[model samples]
Target: MCISRRNESLNVAGTMRRGVCLAGCALLCAFSACTMGPNFDAPPAPRAERIEHGEPVADVMDAAGAAQRFSNDATLSRDWWTTFGSAAVDRAVTDALVANPTLASAQAALRESEDDMRAGAGVFYPQIDASFGASRQKYSPLRVGSGQPPVIFNLFTLSAQVSYALDIWGGERRSLEALRAQTDAQRHALAAAYLTLSANVVNTMIAYAAYGDEIAATREMIALVGEQVSVTHSQFTAGVAAYSAVLTLENEKATLEATVPALEQRREQAGNLLAALSGSMPSQWIAPEVSLENIVLPAVLPRAVSSELVRQRPDIRQAEAALHVASARIGVATANLFPSVTLTAGGGYGNRSMNALLSQTGQAWSAAADVTAPLFHGGTLWFERRAAIDAYDQARAVYDQVVLAAFEQVADTLRALENDAHTLDADARALATSEEALRLVQAEYEAGTVGYLSILVADAQRHQARIAWLQGVAQRLQDTVALYAALGGGWYGNADG
Candidate 1:
């Protein structure tokens, strides 16, 4: 500042110049405090906006009907996976929540974000430090006494200096805000990870259950095929049935026997996967032998409106929070282009003698505001601003994708539930018909009218029916899990921002 003395000849131009400088400083402070980058406008919900039309399923089915009824309900039950009503299944899900590696990893990330928030917030507070040290120094002869005598001295420093950023430009404030948003996002991420873990545990349990039924069906078919072979052998020995009939019976038994190993292999594989999900050693973990056929599927499912996903789904909210952080970052980068003002004031007392350190003569005090403006940079500031704008655009796109993907998953799960239930019902009917057909074939063979081969073919049809029914049961269970995940119901369902 060109401080012309008050007594000197002060002109209008001089007064105007000082006024302009003050005004410019004030404006810089104001602009630097501004949020410069693209503001985070929440992405539009095109699919959810027309949810009534957006839903792909007709409301006639029980699954869609439940969804229509609970559109506004919160939390959707923490044990959504346990709706299957099996104590064993409930135990499995609980174990996974406690032991799953993925959830542990996500939890660690959330803790890290919390630390980031603390570190960022620390910038707003004053920093105080004290230094104490003892040193012996030798005075230079030429400087002290003109080569008369060298003096040995002991020195120590024990002063506390406190400094604070003042947040005059609000840059630190904006940065801290960004960190807080990131912490929220990390929390949501933890919730989403939990949802995934729960779904996997449930799905793996169902898969193991289905394989159990397949194993039983295959064994039953093999035994029945053995019975038919024995019947053929007796007839041929009695000179009633042909050698070709016996050959056919042997081939059917062989095919049934082949199915046993494949079914057992699949069951073992499912058990191994379940062990992994539960974070247990496969060598030590043994999945319970459960039948898919006996497991009761949920009669009613939780459903909610499209907008409910934005509030409930952790992944979508995580994405939205991340966008908020990114938007705040733009303000941080923009603040760098303006002058920064920091106000600092401190007072202290010191002396060579400890007793005199408390005297007024040793007292010192100071107060001043340091104003700094950017003099030069190699286009770093401009590029950073442009980058902030680009980051906002990227974050917006990610938010949109997260929302759309969540909506699409819900639509897909609902459709699967409808279709799989219809299929399971049809397969049940087919099983009944197949059993009846075998009965008829057995009666005809007993009357000596139809060949034993006819009974063997009927047995094959019965086995196929049982396999199909078991597969349908498995599909229906997986569809249920999919629906729960698709709706984005998890830990965040009860979370309040």
Candidate 2:
């Protein structure tokens, strides 16, 4: 009997030592184990060797007398708007960045995503909980065959418990990785918002300035037409010009006057849009006065390479981060198919008398380990894993689509800018010819060498040419803004900007 008892004691000691060693090894393995899942790597470079758009040629056409050349490999500053050399433009963008609701929302979303990632990291450590309880119970001595009266008793308990999941298969690590990728995606999205907001403010301001100039030019035309109408009516009264000629002059004057209201209306609309973009009510906001003459176009524009474009564009980077997150999720789903091992330990003191709970003799302790495996779940785990894989494939396709669209935008902007220069040159030439024609005819009419109708014809043509030229100039300016936006708002760095 003595030998048996000694053997039992040895066996119990051996079990306790093995349990401790096993827990220690699990902790070490948790720290050292590799994460399961296909590791995320940056997508490979596009196959195409060069940008599909034509290479930046020399300054071919002078747009509004402001010529520009594309300089490849130049570093674009984050404050690209300041390059326009317009104080009003710079101020407008600054205000919008500070006040815009969309940008604020995006920034808030980024912060939330980062916090979620931080929370997910807690899974790497153990979970601990403290608990206390007090209860009244009745003892059942009759069931125990003690043949004694049942007694009401008070039970008090206090305990602390600890649990940890050994990440042998790396599900928790993959979950954290996925969350980190999501945070990265939100950060890129915020950058994209900044780029978009700034670009919109700049473009809107350009239109506002153009509309103001157009309205002024229209008023000038109205004045000229009014003078031409008086001269034609006097000629008709003298019987030297037909009444129809006077009617034509009157009609031209009215038409010119009519355009003024439309231009004014458009200018007002632009102001209202600027108000919203700057995050204010129209009544409370004042749009800056801008004109083609006052705004300076960039003389040397930076051009990024196709490969660099993917790296610089925020949307592309955002999409790539999403892809990484999707890829990581597949590992999380796959890990669910395997067994989950959990270790739990608890210790506490309990006694029928609350005061006796402090005694060492009332102390108790317990440790347990649990392993759960999916034996049958109606194929749910299998389908979920498959769904995760499909989701990853979908993300890959979407990433490819984003890259293609980004390149397409860059190409469109390049072509628009190239064409704008030529169009501006043509418009400028037409304006010069129209002004000369009007000049000669007006001088002749004053000298009584040409009929009043000749002056009316010249004025009409000159009015159209001036307005067209103004529109062309505005197009060139807006296109420059477009190029900046297409290049992903000039975002690029090793870390968050």
Candidate 2 overall Cα lDDT vs. reference? Answer: 0.85
The per-prediction CA RMSD against the true structure, in angstroms, equals 6.2, 8.5
Candidate 2: residue pairs that collide: none
Model 2: how far residue 203 lies from native, Å: 0.6
Task: Please provide TM-scores, in order, for all candidate models, with all chains considered together.
Answer: 0.85, 0.89
For model 1, residues 283-384, the per-residue Cα lDDT tens digits are: 977776566645667665666577567878888889989899888888888778767767676666665555565678767777777888887899898789
lDDT for model 1 comes to 0.76
